[model samples]
Each structure stands twice: as C-alpha cells, then as structure tokens.
Target: MSNPDTSSGTLPSHEIIVIPPSGHQDRLLLLDQCIHVRIDVFVHEQQFSLDVEVDEHDPIATHFLLRLVPSLTPIGTIRAYRAEGEKYYKLSRLAVLKPYRKYHFGRDLVLALHRWVNEDAIRSGLQVARVVCHSQLPVKGFYAKYGYQPEGDEFDEDGAPHQKMVAYPS
Candidate 1:
C-alpha cells in the first residue's frame, strides 16, 4: 500500500510518504514533480544547464516524491534507472527544497530509495544496487557515509565538478 500522506491528495503537517511508479499516469505525475523540483534546485537556482538536468531516460525510470502536509506541495524527489547491459540500477536526480535541507530530508530520500531498490532487486533476483552522484567535492564524504565509493577521478558536468560513485548492498 502507498503511504496515505503521499497518496494523491492533501496531507497533514506531520506525515509524508513515498509513492512508486505503477502505471502511465502515476509515472508521468512522478516525473513531472521530480523534474520540477530538481530543475528548480539544480538548474534555475544553481545555474546548471537545464539540458544536462532533464534527460531522455526520465520517462521510463522509477521515480519517487516527498510532499508537504496540508498543501500537497512537493518537497523532494529521487529516481533510479537501469544501466544498459548491466544488472545494476543507477540512482540519480535526488533533490529537496532549500527550506527543508537541514532536516535530513536528503538522507531520508536516499534511504527510501535504497529500500525500494533493494526490495526490487531481491524480487527480480538481481545482485546489486549502484548509484552515481555528481561528486560535489563537499558531498563526496556525505555519500561515503552512506556506503558509496568513488570510482574514478573528478569530471565536469555543466561546469560543476563531479565524480562517479557506486554503492553495493552488504
């Protein structure tokens, strides 16, 4: 069952739930909300190119959202896509509203995604869950705290520094 707080309606102040993509309508809604919040933070606010942020893979990927109570406003989102020719999932596009940053919503979003991916993998008989975040120098440690390891030297994405990282279930 989907969390009532995050279902298709208004919620109260103390609750928020993550929803899974099940059908076309649900998937489209999740994509729009996720893209909106991510672009607002990564593109418009941070000056990252919009082209780099919105990608063709979004339409088919699994998406999730966190919403505010009473207002049903979207507060955060995360997504994962299957890497071609591989048995792993690539988690990406994690974002949360600026006002909610200090409350660990970002980490919560990640943990939620981790749960979703792990369950899906076990159900499908898959072996690993992998994620790559733009190695923002400061946040590399953050990802490390969650078990992601840097795979290579830093690279640039829309003029911002980044590095590839991966996570595996223990």
Candidate 2:
C-alpha cells in the first residue's frame, strides 16, 4: 500500500525507507531509534514496568524505522519477533514521536510491516502470516478493524490491562 500523505501538506523532498532486521549499519541505527522511542513512551511516559520494555530478544528481532529526509532523523518505529516457536510474528513496541503522530506515521509503519511479512512469506513459500498484538483493552477495536481477533482473556502487562490478539493473513 502507498504511504499516507506525510508531506506537511506541501510536497516533501525526503523519502521514507523501511529497513528489515538484516539490513546494514545504517539500518541498525534506525532500529536503535525505534527502540529508544518505545522505551521513552512505554517505559517513561506510561510508567510501564521497565522490564517489560527491554529484552534480549531485541537484538535478533525485526525492526522498522521511519526516517525523515534531509535530516534523516528517525521519527517512528515498530518491531516484530518470531513467536510460538517461529510459527508466528509478534509485533510490539510501536511508537511515533509526539510531534509526528499527526501525520499518520503509526499507521504507515504498520502497513509497512504487513507488506514486509507478506513478501517474506511468499519468498519462503508459506501460506499465511501471523501477527500478535498486545493492545490496551479500550483500543482493541482499533486492531480489530485491521482484522486482528482476540486470542484469549484480557491480561495485565506492565500494570495496564491488555488483550492478546492475533491476525492471520492468507
């Protein structure tokens, strides 16, 4: 899918690239930005337990970063990791900077991940792709709109109520 209009209402000179986990040095820098945003938002702002925010899995997980042109500053990030013994991909730690949230960057980041997963599945000859999301209870409907279904009862994570949800793409 095409990216949403993030051009400040005027044409933008910068281009947005989605870097996979295996990308090179520059890509690793972008991934770091994504992790930083998540830590800032979920760990600091929301007071989520610090332990819930960082983990050893990060180094091996797939990450996505949204970089602006010219300055090339990363403004948003999302991550995906293998789940259920590599049978599914769990998407987590999605965050966009406060100033850039108005541009629909979060949605764009998600769509980019979805596209990447689809492409990966095709190349690997897989029939379907799976993504799991841990969503705040009230916002579960937002994910539902994207075809995610609750997997089980609500659970508490980092002191906040969340529901486990899964999406299957054929």
Candidate 3:
C-alpha cells in the first residue's frame, strides 16, 4: 500500500535543501541531519555496518537533505561528488524513511542533484558528461526511469549486490 502521506492525492509540503560545502559553522549541523537519515535507512534498516556506511567520500560530497514542512523534520538524504579528473559525478547514499518512500522523495532527490550539477557545470564552464551510481541491484530500475544505464555486471558492495549505472544529461 502507498503511504497515507501521499495516497491522499495532495502533495506534501516538503523541501530538498542542497548543502554545498562552504565555510559555515552550521554546516556540521546540516550534515548531521543527512547522517541521521543514512544511519536510519542504511545502517539500521539495511544492516550495513557503520564502518562501511560512512566513508571518505562524505567529506568531499555535496549533500542534500529533505525536510517536511511545518515541522521541518529531516526525512531523506543523498550525496554526490565528482569522480577524480573525470567528467563524471558519482551519486550515492540515497535514502528515504520507510513511511516517506511512497512519496517519490527518492526520485525528487536524484532530480534535484542533477539540476544542481547542470547549473554548477554551467557556472564553472565545465562539461559534465554523466552521473554514475553503484546502485543496489534491486533498485536499478528506479535509476533507469531517470535514464541511467547499467555499465557492468553486478558486484558485491558491503555484502550486498550492486551494479554500476551511468546517466548522461539530455
């Protein structure tokens, strides 16, 4: 069944805030919110070990946090970083709470990240060729809906099956 939060046919008042790396004290607080969501969905729910869930890329990645309006509680998050010396950006750690999954928050998060990439690329006069993800095999189709194509055979990541997928901007 779809979440009641969305089944009513009325869009929920929510926002995806982009947390670009900057010199701000509150940046850690914002990142804590992103970490909380990831811990809930990735570590607790999915059983990924904490060591594997938190990685070196986190410090360099651009993070996104989704907050429901009124209460403004953080409920979803995702992050992306550019692949070294390459025209590719890698998206990772996308998660939405169980109740919020039906709201299409995950899809919105990806789209928002893509939008940010396009704008940043234009502003910096850099050509970004693609966005890539090491998606869990089960949800590869979710990324496909956004035009990502599988790049290689499935491989084990943190004891779970994952596959490389890439999406070129249209």
In order, what lDDT does every prediction score? 0.73, 0.73, 0.86
Best by TM-score: 3
Best by lDDT: 3
Error (Å) of candidate 3 at residue 96 is 0.5
Q: Tell me the alpha-carbon RMSD of every candidate.
A: 6.1, 4.8, 2.8
Q: Model 1 over residues 1-170: C-alpha lDDT tens digits?
A: 12233343332353345554556456667567778999888887788888788887676677778876666778788877776666877878888776566566777778877887888788878866655555676678877878889998888877878888888754
In candidate 3, which residue pairs get closer than 3 Å at backbone N, Cα or C atoms, i.e. clash?
A: none
In candidate 3, how many Å is residue 32 off?
0.4
Error of 1 at 124 (Å): 2.3
| Pairs of residues at least 3 apart in sequence or in different chains that clash in candidate 1 | 11-70, 135-163
For all candidates, the clash counts are 2, 0, 0
Model 1 stretches with alpha carbons more than 4 Å out: 1-22
- What is candidate 2's CA lDDT for residue 30? 69
Model 1, position 143: C-alpha lDDT score? 76
Instruction: Kindly list the per-residue Cα lDDT of model 3 for residues 1-170, writing each as its tens digit.
Output: 22335656576789999885767777889999999889989998999999988898888889999988877788899998885676678999999988777678999999998998787667767866478999998899999999999997999989999999999765
Q: How many backbone clashes does candidate 2 have?
A: 0
Q: Candidate 3, after superposition: displacement of residue 111 in Å?
A: 0.5
